[model samples]
Target: MNLTISVVLLAGIALAVVLRLKSATLTGAVIALLFGFYLADTDAAPTVNELVTAIADAVRGIGN
Candidate 1:
């Protein structure tokens, strides 16, 4: 649960930076957000979550 929140916050910050730099338009962001919202309801969500958690764990391990 904590990892999920951290990942979300990190992604939000990255999205904000991209928006500020005008690298992605508001429409594109909105579309992507909606896509994610819908995607989370599907069976692939578990696979996605596991993938993210595994990546996060690997990143954390790098410092040790």
Candidate 2:
């Protein structure tokens, strides 16, 4: 139930919908999956995670 995860999932769904509307859903999804797998094994993953966490924290703070 983490806010960051929720936001990410929602964003992903939105992206998927957009891709589908453009008739590129399957191709885009496959490419994205491959890219994600590649990124996950990189040394920069921690930095990416931290950046995403910071963004989520900032967004949360906006509503307070």
Candidate 3:
């Protein structure tokens, strides 16, 4: 559950970056989010989840 929240927070940050850069519109962000939702339902979701977990672990290890 924590990892899921982390992923969502990171994705929101990404959208904010895009907005700042003027490279993405609100519609584009909505479409991207929908795409992510669809992708998460696919078989690739596990791989993505594992990758996020690994990244989170590495960041945590860096602090310790």
Q: RMSD, each candidate, Å?
A: 12.4, 13.1, 11.6
Candidate lDDT scores, in order, read 0.72, 0.69, 0.74
Which of candidates 1 and 2 is the stronger one according to lDDT?
1
User: Could you give the candidate ranking by TM-score, starting with the highest?
Assistant: 1, 2, 3
Worst 10 residues of 2 by lDDT: 2-11
Pairs in clash, predicted candidate 1: none
TM-score winner between 1 and 2, please give it: 1
Where does the lowest 10-residue lDDT sum fall in candidate 3?
1-10
- Writing each residue's lDDT as its tens digit, candidate 2 over 1-64 gives 6555443454456566656678566766765675566666768689999999999999999999
Q: Which residue segments of model 3 deviate by more than 4 Å?
A: 1-22
Q: In model 2, which residue pairs have backbone atoms overlapping below 3 Å?
A: none
